[model samples]
Target: MTAFRIALLATTVLPVLAVAQQMDPSMQMPGMGAGSTTEVAPPRTSAPAQAGMNGDHDMGAMRGTTSSLPRRVGAKRAAPSPAGPLASHNAGTMDGMGGIEAQREMPNPPPPPAALSGPAHAADLVYNPSDMATAREELRAEQGDLRAYRVLIDRLETQFQEGGNGYKWDAQAWYGSDINKLWLKSEGNGTYRGRVEEGDLQVLWSRAISPYFDLQAGGRVNFGPGPQRTDAVIALQALMPYSYNVEASLFLSNKGELRSRLEAEYDLLITQRLILQPRVELNLSAQNIRELGVGAGLSTVEAGLRLRYEFIPEFAPYVGIEYERKVGNTAGYARASGEDVGSFKYLVGLRSWF
Candidate 1:
């Protein structure tokens, strides 16, 4: 019975001691109390007591650090933020505050040319060098420098006239790559039963000066029944606005004579396979050539309207009406020669290109 009473008394006394420690500061264990080595904050003042003090009493300066306070917890201070470019948005700018990362912000200069790093042909390493060279050359040729040729029989037509029957031809063949070509152009008119009246052949070096035009410089040789001569020629051939094909040529004859010719033609599609083409050619001479029945100023002008059915784009047969006029002094020369100054003829022709 004495042992049970002693256990009960011990439990009651322990609770009483804990309550006393919490209610009274002086009752706490020695090191944990207000007078211990660790500093203690000043006792807090009641609201009325704080109001009676001077407003500028500088309470924070007098109070000790709250590190000793009860019912409070402590945390580690945040690490100082990095101070360079990645620190803030303004760190990479040019305004005196920015670092190296800000000064040259353009994309890293294009990775040093990938082209020049290896052998001229990497295949050369694994294949027979000679065969590789040959294949590489073929690739370049097919890509850019390949040679090609085309023959365009732009005009091959026979004419029926009150005076007589005649044929006319204007054709060109060119051989080259896209930027440079050698051109052969020929044109002539003659009666069916007689000799060629006027004809010329041109050997030109043509260079593409624009996407739509070529500038050609070459030599021309006149042939047929007329006075034979050689001329230096410079010409422009262009596909102009609205799909108009234009050719203008200036010629300086061996005899110091100058002449020019301009031709323009346009195709109007009536149907995918049927087309109407209206074309004009003007010939002008700087001076008269009595031997050739030519005169100064405008020599001749011809205009034609043709309707063609293109069975295939590479070949088209056309039938057309043409009006030809001899102008200025050339008209007088034609009259003197017992020829008509103006005439209209109907013709059929085939246009082909390859």
Candidate 2:
């Protein structure tokens, strides 16, 4: 029994000594007499997390020793966040609000000065106003909204078809402002040594309806081989999406004849100066005006493809293949007169504008 008691005391006493040795040197033992001069052992080597937990304690004078505590006063503070204010941006929004302008109505801006709102000729202020006015008048006449005239010889060429070689011309001239214009168009075709087979002149007034189209109203006079005729014309010229050009016209003749025409063209660019143009035209009539050799249904269609190279933008020389066919009653009339109803023609032409 005496040996057993000795072993129990040894075990308990050794463990208590070991725990005391591992504690911080300065910390006092609980329930132990004060000023005993017993030295505490150095801290034991342990895992970092265990060191942190062990380092944190209620012991006075030991609080600053923990590695988790900030060394400098400001080091523990988080960074300030952004306010998303206008000055943080380029200082202004498009509506002219600056700074933190939320929920605030923009104040009315001051009106412009009288000089800024008046005629732009500021020379009138320093020089003789009348002389400056006269100078401004001359400038206005030579510039801005005044030089609105264009004359184009769109096609003036000869055709080489299966039957015989022929020549044709289509030209237009217009003079006016952006919104309104007087337009003249004429087209005629004839055999090289023969009379004009078909010809017409249209004198029209054109009004812009949209950015891409114009509405035109006018008169048309048909001349040449057919019966002399006068007709009222209404037309539309438009630039369709994908850059197609379209023209449609309705004609009501003095003899109560009704007819219509539609034309469409597209330009495909092979290079900066090379272009391929494909064009198609259809003519229709509601009644058979036999005197004009007209059709009751569809009358005619002309389709052509041309490749041109521009020397200057205003001048291009072209070579093309064209197919012309007379249809319906018009074809019957053409056949009765022994005229060729359809043919494929190879043509060379100059296209120009000034």
Candidate 3:
């Protein structure tokens, strides 16, 4: 029983001692009244004191509180922002963040889009029909230029033929100056007539069908004849190893009559410029020998061999001999009229051209 009482007493005393220890010494002074709650000013609220201080207050522990008091009221705490657009409007009006008045400081409005532009800029902005038309015209001119060049190439390549075959055409003109002679004679008779004659000009035209053949036409004027006899000749020439030429002619006289003559020659080339030619000429007339007294009647045949040496490829000198025979009424006229009708002839002359 004594032990229990002692434990109870110890517990009560411990509580009393804790209460005494917590009491402020200054409040416990002699004049202080006991058993009364003294009214004390809680430490003034501080800028950060509210944040740091807990409810347990010791007035004696407040150091640096006086100096820490607001110098002026802290520039008023920004009110909690109102919601949404209202807060944005209030913020925009604040002097620190200038109002819409800031727009007044901007430069005047920019000029039109043309103000700082170049041709490329204009091109981008432009749309017009005239520009399209100019482009089309340029394209057409280019096409025409290409076509013209093509035509020129075709002309050069063709050398000009009737068809599209591209075969070339050629024409040639030639002149031959010749001295001619004829001798006429009657077979089985002593009568003979001979004459020396020459032509002033012989003009010919020829078309080369190929390398080997030629088609020819020409005319000759016999200036040696006082009456001016002329002849038109047609021929075909074959260029063989021994070149062969055949010609048919119509002889015209002052008397207004036409006589046909055929002549053929074979030429053997002895050199590039020299040739040996064997030739034959036959003459026939429409009338009896009595009509043309000088020509020894009607049918005449002459054959000869000639040697021609070309001084230039286009010119040559020739010497030949020919024996001629006159037949039919031509022999009769010559016998009765005692006219010089035909003979054998040896002649020299030039065969030439340019």
- Identify the runs in model 2 with alpha carbons over 4 angstroms from their true place: 1-144
Itemize residue pairs with steric clashes in candidate 3. Answer: 184-342, 184-343, 185-342, 193-341, 193-342, 289-297, 297-330
Tell me the tens digit of each residue's lDDT in model 1 across 1-354: 999999999999978655643443434453454435432234566889768865643332342322113321122223435553234333345466554555566466666777678887788889999998898789989998879999999889999888898999999999999899999999999998999988999999999999999999999999997678899999999998889999999999999999999999999988999999999999999999888778999999999999999999999999999999999899998899899999999999999999
Q: Candidate 2 residues 1-354, lDDT tens each?
A: 999999999999989877754454445457555445544344455588565653433222232343332122212323223542222344465454653485376577677686467656667768998998888888877675575899998788889977689998989999998778999999999997789998999999999899899999999998997678899999999988888999999999998889999999998999989999999999999999887777798999999999999999899999999998999889999899888899998989999999
lDDT of 2: 0.82
**Between candidates 2 and 3, which one is better according to lDDT?**
2
Mind giving the per-residue lDDT tens digits that candidate 3 earns over 133-187?
6876787666632221100110001111121222111122332211111111111
Q: TM-scores for all candidates? A: 0.64, 0.64, 0.35
Clashing pairs in 2: none
What's model 2's lDDT at 267? 88
Better of 2 and 3 by TM-score: 2
Distance from true location, Cα of 35 in model 3, Å:
99
Candidate 1 vs candidate 3: the TM-score winner is 1
